[model samples]
Target: MGPITSDQNAYAYSIYHLILYQKMLNNQFDTLGKLLTVTEKQVTGPIYHGLFSTAILTAHNFLTEFDKYFKADSGAAKEKIVLVKQALKPVIKEIKKWKDLENFRDHVLAHNFRNKHTGYTSVFSDSTFLRYDIPQTVSDLAILIQCIDFIGRAIQRYFQAEYDSVHTLIVQQRSGQSKKSMTVEELEQYLNQLNQEVRPAIQELDNKYGIEVKGGAGETLDHDRR
Candidate 1:
Protein backbone atom coordinates (compact mmCIF):
# COMPACT_ATOMS: atom_id res chain seq x y z
CA MET A 1 0.00 0.00 0.00
CA GLY A 2 2.95 2.35 0.68
CA PRO A 3 6.53 2.70 -0.53
CA ILE A 4 8.73 -0.07 0.88
CA THR A 5 11.22 1.20 3.43
CA SER A 6 14.93 0.51 3.14
CA ASP A 7 14.86 -1.98 5.98
CA GLN A 8 11.98 -3.84 4.38
CA ASN A 9 13.78 -3.80 1.06
CA ALA A 10 16.95 -5.19 2.61
CA TYR A 11 15.02 -7.80 4.55
CA ALA A 12 13.16 -8.86 1.44
CA TYR A 13 16.39 -9.07 -0.50
CA SER A 14 17.92 -11.31 2.14
CA ILE A 15 14.95 -13.65 1.95
CA TYR A 16 15.19 -13.67 -1.82
CA HIS A 17 18.88 -14.51 -1.75
CA LEU A 18 18.37 -17.26 0.80
CA ILE A 19 15.68 -18.78 -1.38
CA LEU A 20 17.86 -18.47 -4.46
CA TYR A 21 20.84 -20.16 -2.84
CA GLN A 22 18.67 -22.80 -1.26
CA LYS A 23 17.22 -23.69 -4.63
CA MET A 24 20.65 -23.78 -6.17
CA LEU A 25 21.86 -26.11 -3.45
CA ASN A 26 18.85 -28.34 -3.94
CA ASN A 27 19.33 -28.42 -7.68
CA GLN A 28 22.98 -29.39 -7.32
CA PHE A 29 22.14 -32.24 -4.98
CA ASP A 30 19.27 -33.35 -7.16
CA THR A 31 21.51 -33.54 -10.18
CA LEU A 32 24.11 -35.45 -8.20
CA GLY A 33 21.51 -37.92 -7.02
CA LYS A 34 20.35 -38.61 -10.55
CA LEU A 35 23.88 -38.96 -11.87
CA LEU A 36 24.78 -41.42 -9.14
CA THR A 37 21.67 -43.41 -9.88
CA VAL A 38 22.37 -43.55 -13.60
CA THR A 39 25.97 -44.53 -13.15
CA GLU A 40 25.44 -46.86 -10.17
CA LYS A 41 28.99 -46.20 -9.08
CA GLN A 42 30.82 -44.47 -6.29
CA VAL A 43 31.52 -40.77 -6.74
CA THR A 44 34.85 -39.97 -8.42
CA GLY A 45 36.67 -37.67 -10.76
CA PRO A 46 35.72 -34.48 -12.57
CA ILE A 47 31.93 -34.70 -12.87
CA TYR A 48 31.35 -35.55 -9.22
CA HIS A 49 34.00 -33.05 -8.16
CA GLY A 50 32.41 -30.29 -10.21
CA LEU A 51 28.92 -30.95 -8.80
CA PHE A 52 30.17 -31.35 -5.25
CA SER A 53 32.12 -28.12 -5.47
CA THR A 54 29.06 -26.19 -6.59
CA ALA A 55 26.94 -27.82 -3.88
CA ILE A 56 29.34 -26.88 -1.09
CA LEU A 57 29.75 -23.31 -2.32
CA THR A 58 25.99 -22.90 -2.63
CA ALA A 59 25.59 -24.36 0.84
CA HIS A 60 28.11 -21.91 2.27
CA ASN A 61 26.26 -19.03 0.65
CA PHE A 62 22.96 -20.23 2.10
CA LEU A 63 24.29 -20.64 5.61
CA THR A 64 26.01 -17.23 5.71
CA GLU A 65 22.99 -15.46 4.29
CA PHE A 66 20.74 -17.27 6.76
CA ASP A 67 22.95 -16.13 9.64
CA LYS A 68 22.73 -12.50 8.57
CA TYR A 69 18.96 -12.58 8.89
CA PHE A 70 18.37 -14.89 11.83
CA LYS A 71 21.39 -14.59 14.09
CA ALA A 72 20.95 -13.00 17.54
CA ASP A 73 22.44 -9.64 16.56
CA SER A 74 20.63 -9.52 13.26
CA GLY A 75 18.23 -6.61 12.76
CA ALA A 76 15.37 -9.02 12.17
CA ALA A 77 12.51 -8.71 14.60
CA LYS A 78 13.06 -10.53 17.88
CA GLU A 79 9.88 -12.53 17.52
CA LYS A 80 10.72 -13.54 13.98
CA ILE A 81 14.20 -14.62 15.00
CA VAL A 82 12.80 -16.60 17.89
CA LEU A 83 10.29 -18.30 15.68
CA VAL A 84 12.93 -19.27 13.14
CA LYS A 85 15.41 -20.49 15.74
CA GLN A 86 12.82 -22.49 17.59
CA ALA A 87 11.68 -24.15 14.40
CA LEU A 88 15.18 -24.81 13.10
CA LYS A 89 17.22 -25.33 16.26
CA PRO A 90 18.38 -28.85 15.43
CA VAL A 91 19.20 -28.06 11.83
CA ILE A 92 21.06 -24.89 12.82
CA LYS A 93 23.02 -26.75 15.45
CA GLU A 94 24.06 -29.43 12.96
CA ILE A 95 25.08 -26.78 10.47
CA LYS A 96 27.20 -24.98 13.07
CA LYS A 97 29.01 -28.21 13.89
CA TRP A 98 30.13 -28.42 10.26
CA LYS A 99 33.37 -26.52 10.77
CA ASP A 100 35.17 -28.77 8.33
CA LEU A 101 32.79 -27.84 5.54
CA GLU A 102 33.29 -24.17 6.31
CA ASN A 103 37.04 -24.58 6.42
CA PHE A 104 37.16 -26.40 3.11
CA ARG A 105 34.99 -23.80 1.48
CA ASP A 106 37.11 -20.97 2.83
CA HIS A 107 40.55 -22.46 2.20
CA VAL A 108 40.14 -24.65 -0.85
CA LEU A 109 37.14 -23.45 -2.84
CA ALA A 110 36.70 -19.77 -2.13
CA HIS A 111 40.27 -18.58 -1.72
CA ASN A 112 43.83 -19.12 -2.88
CA PHE A 113 46.43 -19.49 -0.18
CA ARG A 114 49.73 -21.35 0.20
CA ASN A 115 50.49 -24.00 2.75
CA LYS A 116 52.78 -22.79 5.47
CA HIS A 117 54.95 -25.88 5.38
CA THR A 118 55.15 -26.62 1.67
CA GLY A 119 54.86 -23.03 0.43
CA TYR A 120 52.73 -24.47 -2.33
CA THR A 121 49.05 -24.06 -3.21
CA SER A 122 46.86 -25.44 -0.46
CA VAL A 123 44.82 -27.65 -2.77
CA PHE A 124 46.73 -30.82 -2.01
CA SER A 125 49.26 -30.90 0.79
CA ASP A 126 49.98 -33.65 3.28
CA SER A 127 49.04 -31.37 6.15
CA THR A 128 46.30 -29.32 4.52
CA PHE A 129 44.75 -31.86 2.21
CA LEU A 130 41.05 -32.29 2.99
CA ARG A 131 39.18 -35.32 1.71
CA TYR A 132 35.44 -34.83 1.58
CA ASP A 133 33.07 -37.50 2.78
CA ILE A 134 30.49 -37.45 0.03
CA PRO A 135 27.83 -39.39 1.92
CA GLN A 136 28.19 -37.20 4.96
CA THR A 137 28.05 -34.05 2.90
CA VAL A 138 24.88 -35.27 1.20
CA SER A 139 23.26 -35.95 4.56
CA ASP A 140 24.27 -32.54 5.88
CA LEU A 141 23.01 -30.80 2.77
CA ALA A 142 19.68 -32.59 3.20
CA ILE A 143 19.40 -31.15 6.69
CA LEU A 144 20.29 -27.72 5.36
CA ILE A 145 17.53 -28.06 2.81
CA GLN A 146 15.13 -28.85 5.63
CA CYS A 147 16.23 -25.69 7.41
CA ILE A 148 15.74 -23.61 4.29
CA ASP A 149 12.28 -25.07 3.72
CA PHE A 150 11.19 -24.49 7.30
CA ILE A 151 12.46 -20.90 7.32
CA GLY A 152 10.72 -20.18 4.04
CA ARG A 153 7.43 -21.55 5.34
CA ALA A 154 7.77 -19.72 8.64
CA ILE A 155 8.41 -16.40 6.93
CA GLN A 156 5.46 -16.89 4.66
CA ARG A 157 3.19 -17.83 7.54
CA TYR A 158 4.31 -15.33 10.18
CA PHE A 159 5.12 -12.35 8.01
CA GLN A 160 2.34 -12.88 5.55
CA ALA A 161 1.72 -9.22 4.83
CA GLU A 162 5.31 -8.21 4.17
CA TYR A 163 6.06 -11.41 2.23
CA ASP A 164 3.01 -11.04 0.08
CA SER A 165 3.62 -7.38 -0.65
CA VAL A 166 7.27 -7.90 -1.44
CA HIS A 167 6.61 -10.99 -3.53
CA THR A 168 3.92 -9.20 -5.50
CA LEU A 169 6.22 -6.26 -6.23
CA ILE A 170 9.02 -8.60 -7.20
CA VAL A 171 6.84 -10.49 -9.63
CA GLN A 172 5.53 -7.29 -11.13
CA GLN A 173 9.00 -5.87 -11.61
CA ARG A 174 10.40 -9.08 -13.04
CA SER A 175 7.60 -10.07 -15.38
CA GLY A 176 5.67 -6.82 -15.81
CA GLN A 177 2.66 -8.78 -14.62
CA SER A 178 -0.05 -7.11 -12.58
CA LYS A 179 -0.42 -10.22 -10.43
CA LYS A 180 -1.93 -9.65 -7.02
CA SER A 181 -0.55 -11.23 -3.88
CA MET A 182 -2.09 -14.44 -2.66
CA THR A 183 -4.46 -14.47 0.27
CA VAL A 184 -3.36 -16.22 3.44
CA GLU A 185 -5.45 -19.27 2.60
CA GLU A 186 -4.06 -19.33 -0.91
CA LEU A 187 -0.53 -19.10 0.41
CA GLU A 188 -1.10 -21.96 2.80
CA GLN A 189 -2.63 -24.07 0.06
CA TYR A 190 0.22 -23.28 -2.28
CA LEU A 191 2.82 -24.23 0.31
CA ASN A 192 1.02 -27.48 0.99
CA GLN A 193 0.84 -28.19 -2.71
CA LEU A 194 4.54 -27.51 -3.04
CA ASN A 195 5.32 -29.85 -0.17
CA GLN A 196 3.22 -32.54 -1.72
CA GLU A 197 5.08 -32.17 -4.99
CA VAL A 198 8.58 -31.88 -3.54
CA ARG A 199 8.52 -34.37 -0.71
CA PRO A 200 7.84 -37.47 -2.78
CA ALA A 201 10.44 -36.52 -5.35
CA ILE A 202 13.07 -36.05 -2.69
CA GLN A 203 12.08 -39.26 -0.98
CA GLU A 204 12.28 -41.18 -4.23
CA LEU A 205 15.76 -39.87 -4.83
CA ASP A 206 16.76 -40.74 -1.28
CA ASN A 207 15.41 -44.24 -1.62
CA LYS A 208 17.00 -44.77 -4.99
CA TYR A 209 20.38 -43.37 -3.93
CA GLY A 210 20.35 -44.51 -0.30
CA ILE A 211 20.76 -40.94 0.88
CA GLU A 212 19.57 -40.93 4.45
CA VAL A 213 20.38 -38.30 7.02
CA LYS A 214 22.64 -40.25 9.32
CA GLY A 215 23.10 -38.11 12.41
CA GLY A 216 26.08 -40.18 13.46
CA ALA A 217 29.53 -39.02 14.38
CA GLY A 218 31.66 -38.48 11.31
CA GLU A 219 33.72 -35.60 10.04
CA THR A 220 32.48 -33.98 6.84
CA LEU A 221 36.05 -33.95 5.63
CA ASP A 222 39.09 -35.87 6.83
CA HIS A 223 41.60 -33.17 7.65
CA ASP A 224 43.97 -35.41 9.61
CA ARG A 225 44.95 -38.10 7.12
CA ARG A 226 47.97 -37.46 4.93
Candidate 2:
Protein backbone atom coordinates (compact mmCIF):
# COMPACT_ATOMS: atom_id res chain seq x y z
CA MET A 1 0.00 0.00 0.00
CA GLY A 2 1.23 3.48 -0.81
CA PRO A 3 -0.55 5.26 2.02
CA ILE A 4 -2.14 4.63 5.41
CA THR A 5 -5.68 4.35 4.06
CA SER A 6 -4.59 1.98 1.32
CA ASP A 7 -2.68 -0.10 3.83
CA GLN A 8 -5.64 -0.46 6.18
CA ASN A 9 -8.04 -1.21 3.41
CA ALA A 10 -5.62 -3.77 2.07
CA TYR A 11 -5.27 -5.23 5.52
CA ALA A 12 -8.98 -5.34 6.27
CA TYR A 13 -9.78 -6.72 2.86
CA SER A 14 -6.88 -9.11 3.00
CA ILE A 15 -7.82 -10.45 6.39
CA TYR A 16 -11.16 -11.18 4.81
CA HIS A 17 -9.37 -13.12 2.06
CA LEU A 18 -10.73 -10.52 -0.33
CA ILE A 19 -8.21 -10.56 -3.20
CA LEU A 20 -5.20 -9.11 -1.33
CA TYR A 21 -4.99 -10.89 1.99
CA GLN A 22 -1.22 -11.18 2.18
CA LYS A 23 -0.68 -7.60 1.10
CA MET A 24 -2.21 -6.20 4.26
CA LEU A 25 -0.71 -8.71 6.71
CA ASN A 26 2.62 -7.85 5.17
CA ASN A 27 2.19 -4.30 6.51
CA GLN A 28 1.83 -5.34 10.15
CA PHE A 29 -0.43 -3.62 12.70
CA ASP A 30 -0.24 0.16 12.35
CA THR A 31 -3.71 1.13 13.45
CA LEU A 32 -2.80 0.36 17.06
CA GLY A 33 -0.31 3.19 16.86
CA LYS A 34 -3.13 5.50 15.88
CA LEU A 35 -5.33 4.26 18.71
CA LEU A 36 -2.61 5.27 21.17
CA THR A 37 -3.08 8.92 20.29
CA VAL A 38 -6.82 8.49 20.39
CA THR A 39 -6.78 6.82 23.79
CA GLU A 40 -4.44 9.53 25.08
CA LYS A 41 -6.86 12.24 24.02
CA GLN A 42 -9.70 10.28 25.57
CA VAL A 43 -10.92 11.23 29.05
CA THR A 44 -8.98 9.49 31.82
CA GLY A 45 -10.32 7.47 34.77
CA PRO A 46 -13.74 5.86 35.19
CA ILE A 47 -15.05 7.81 32.25
CA TYR A 48 -12.21 6.35 30.21
CA HIS A 49 -14.72 3.71 29.28
CA GLY A 50 -15.78 6.40 26.85
CA LEU A 51 -12.60 5.69 24.96
CA PHE A 52 -13.46 2.01 24.59
CA SER A 53 -17.05 2.85 23.86
CA THR A 54 -15.89 5.33 21.27
CA ALA A 55 -13.66 2.72 19.68
CA ILE A 56 -16.44 0.16 19.60
CA LEU A 57 -18.87 2.78 18.39
CA THR A 58 -16.44 3.79 15.67
CA ALA A 59 -16.35 0.17 14.44
CA HIS A 60 -20.10 -0.14 14.64
CA ASN A 61 -20.45 3.11 12.75
CA PHE A 62 -17.97 1.97 10.13
CA LEU A 63 -19.95 -1.19 9.55
CA THR A 64 -23.15 0.83 9.26
CA GLU A 65 -21.68 3.43 6.96
CA PHE A 66 -20.15 0.73 4.79
CA ASP A 67 -23.19 -1.50 4.87
CA LYS A 68 -23.47 -1.62 1.12
CA TYR A 69 -20.03 -3.18 1.12
CA PHE A 70 -21.01 -5.53 3.93
CA LYS A 71 -23.63 -7.38 1.89
CA ALA A 72 -26.07 -6.63 4.66
CA ASP A 73 -28.11 -3.60 5.68
CA SER A 74 -26.05 -0.45 5.75
CA GLY A 75 -27.18 -0.08 9.34
CA ALA A 76 -27.35 -3.69 10.35
CA ALA A 77 -25.78 -3.10 13.74
CA LYS A 78 -26.62 -6.61 14.72
CA GLU A 79 -23.95 -7.80 12.32
CA LYS A 80 -21.35 -6.59 14.80
CA ILE A 81 -22.80 -8.99 17.29
CA VAL A 82 -22.85 -11.71 14.68
CA LEU A 83 -19.26 -11.07 13.73
CA VAL A 84 -18.24 -11.16 17.35
CA LYS A 85 -20.05 -14.42 17.70
CA GLN A 86 -18.24 -15.82 14.69
CA ALA A 87 -14.85 -14.87 16.05
CA LEU A 88 -15.44 -15.86 19.65
CA LYS A 89 -17.21 -19.09 18.86
CA PRO A 90 -14.00 -21.07 19.14
CA VAL A 91 -12.53 -19.57 22.29
CA ILE A 92 -15.85 -19.60 24.12
CA LYS A 93 -16.16 -23.28 23.49
CA GLU A 94 -12.59 -23.95 24.57
CA ILE A 95 -13.03 -22.04 27.81
CA LYS A 96 -16.48 -23.45 28.34
CA LYS A 97 -17.68 -19.87 28.78
CA TRP A 98 -19.99 -19.50 25.80
CA LYS A 99 -22.80 -17.75 27.60
CA ASP A 100 -20.59 -14.99 28.93
CA LEU A 101 -20.08 -13.21 25.63
CA GLU A 102 -23.60 -13.74 24.36
CA ASN A 103 -24.88 -12.39 27.64
CA PHE A 104 -22.49 -9.44 27.58
CA ARG A 105 -23.62 -8.58 24.09
CA ASP A 106 -27.24 -8.81 25.13
CA HIS A 107 -26.61 -6.72 28.22
CA VAL A 108 -24.97 -4.01 26.17
CA LEU A 109 -27.71 -4.11 23.58
CA ALA A 110 -30.49 -3.37 26.01
CA HIS A 111 -30.00 -1.37 29.23
CA ASN A 112 -29.05 -4.33 31.37
CA PHE A 113 -26.27 -4.01 33.97
CA ARG A 114 -24.27 -7.14 34.60
CA ASN A 115 -20.78 -6.34 33.37
CA LYS A 116 -18.27 -8.26 35.52
CA HIS A 117 -15.90 -5.37 36.04
CA THR A 118 -15.28 -4.36 39.65
CA GLY A 119 -17.49 -1.30 39.44
CA TYR A 120 -19.12 -1.90 36.07
CA THR A 121 -22.65 -1.88 37.44
CA SER A 122 -24.16 0.08 34.60
CA VAL A 123 -24.27 -1.54 31.18
CA PHE A 124 -24.82 0.05 27.79
CA SER A 125 -27.95 2.03 28.61
CA ASP A 126 -27.24 3.42 25.16
CA SER A 127 -24.04 2.92 23.21
CA THR A 128 -23.24 6.51 24.26
CA PHE A 129 -21.34 5.77 27.52
CA LEU A 130 -20.40 3.11 30.06
CA ARG A 131 -19.54 2.87 33.78
CA TYR A 132 -16.22 1.75 35.29
CA ASP A 133 -13.80 2.40 38.13
CA ILE A 134 -10.81 4.70 37.76
CA PRO A 135 -7.65 2.67 38.00
CA GLN A 136 -5.49 3.71 40.93
CA THR A 137 -2.09 2.69 39.51
CA VAL A 138 -0.22 1.83 36.35
CA SER A 139 -1.15 -1.82 36.79
CA ASP A 140 -4.77 -0.90 37.29
CA LEU A 141 -4.88 1.19 34.15
CA ALA A 142 -2.90 -1.50 32.38
CA ILE A 143 -5.65 -4.01 33.10
CA LEU A 144 -8.27 -1.77 31.58
CA ILE A 145 -5.95 -1.07 28.69
CA GLN A 146 -5.55 -4.77 28.09
CA CYS A 147 -9.29 -5.25 27.99
CA ILE A 148 -9.68 -2.34 25.60
CA ASP A 149 -6.95 -3.78 23.43
CA PHE A 150 -8.75 -7.09 23.31
CA ILE A 151 -11.99 -5.40 22.34
CA GLY A 152 -10.31 -3.53 19.53
CA ARG A 153 -8.56 -6.67 18.40
CA ALA A 154 -11.84 -8.54 18.39
CA ILE A 155 -13.50 -5.93 16.18
CA GLN A 156 -10.74 -6.30 13.66
CA ARG A 157 -10.66 -10.09 13.68
CA TYR A 158 -14.42 -10.26 13.42
CA PHE A 159 -14.32 -7.97 10.44
CA GLN A 160 -11.49 -10.03 9.00
CA ALA A 161 -13.36 -13.32 9.35
CA GLU A 162 -16.50 -11.96 7.72
CA TYR A 163 -14.61 -10.18 4.99
CA ASP A 164 -12.52 -13.26 4.31
CA SER A 165 -15.57 -15.45 4.19
CA VAL A 166 -17.13 -13.29 1.51
CA HIS A 167 -13.96 -12.63 -0.45
CA THR A 168 -12.87 -16.25 -0.51
CA LEU A 169 -16.24 -17.34 -1.76
CA ILE A 170 -15.93 -14.96 -4.66
CA VAL A 171 -12.44 -16.19 -5.42
CA GLN A 172 -13.60 -19.77 -5.39
CA GLN A 173 -16.43 -18.97 -7.72
CA ARG A 174 -14.16 -17.21 -10.21
CA SER A 175 -11.65 -20.04 -10.16
CA GLY A 176 -14.29 -22.74 -10.41
CA GLN A 177 -12.91 -23.95 -7.09
CA SER A 178 -16.16 -23.18 -5.35
CA LYS A 179 -17.36 -26.69 -6.00
CA LYS A 180 -14.25 -27.94 -4.24
CA SER A 181 -13.21 -25.11 -1.96
CA MET A 182 -15.71 -24.05 0.66
CA THR A 183 -18.31 -21.80 -0.86
CA VAL A 184 -19.92 -18.98 1.10
CA GLU A 185 -23.20 -20.74 0.65
CA GLU A 186 -21.69 -23.90 2.05
CA LEU A 187 -19.90 -22.13 4.87
CA GLU A 188 -23.03 -20.32 5.93
CA GLN A 189 -25.04 -23.47 5.63
CA TYR A 190 -22.48 -25.17 7.84
CA LEU A 191 -22.61 -22.32 10.34
CA ASN A 192 -26.36 -22.49 10.36
CA GLN A 193 -26.13 -26.19 10.93
CA LEU A 194 -23.76 -25.55 13.77
CA ASN A 195 -26.27 -23.14 15.26
CA GLN A 196 -29.01 -25.60 14.84
CA GLU A 197 -26.78 -28.28 16.33
CA VAL A 198 -26.49 -26.20 19.47
CA ARG A 199 -29.24 -27.89 21.34
CA PRO A 200 -29.20 -25.82 24.52
CA ALA A 201 -27.29 -22.54 24.36
CA ILE A 202 -28.76 -20.34 21.60
CA GLN A 203 -32.29 -21.29 22.50
CA GLU A 204 -31.50 -20.77 26.16
CA LEU A 205 -30.38 -17.32 25.11
CA ASP A 206 -34.02 -16.38 24.71
CA ASN A 207 -35.29 -18.42 27.62
CA LYS A 208 -32.72 -16.91 29.90
CA TYR A 209 -32.64 -13.25 30.92
CA GLY A 210 -29.85 -12.20 28.51
CA ILE A 211 -30.16 -13.79 25.09
CA GLU A 212 -30.40 -11.32 22.21
CA VAL A 213 -27.38 -9.06 21.77
CA LYS A 214 -26.44 -6.16 19.49
CA GLY A 215 -23.94 -3.32 18.90
CA GLY A 216 -22.88 -0.77 16.23
CA ALA A 217 -23.09 2.93 15.41
CA GLY A 218 -25.87 3.24 12.85
CA GLU A 219 -24.91 6.49 11.18
CA THR A 220 -27.50 6.73 8.39
CA LEU A 221 -29.71 5.05 10.96
CA ASP A 222 -29.56 5.11 14.80
CA HIS A 223 -25.75 5.13 15.13
CA ASP A 224 -26.39 4.09 18.69
CA ARG A 225 -27.65 0.49 18.54
CA ARG A 226 -24.40 -1.28 17.84
Query: TM-scores of the models, in the given order?
Result: 0.56, 0.23
Off by over 4 Å in 2: 1-25, 40-180, 214-226
Best by lDDT: 1
Give one digit per residue, the lDDT tens place, for model 2 in 1-226. 1222432443344334322322232222243334345545454444444333333333333323333332333234346645754764553233222123233343452333444442455544433222322232333333333443444456555565545555655666789743456789989898767655664554455446543334311111212332
Q: Please report the candidate that would top TM-score against the real structure.
A: 1
**In candidate 1, how many clashes are counted?**
0
- Can you give the lDDT of residue 140 in candidate 2? 33
lDDT of each: 0.59, 0.40
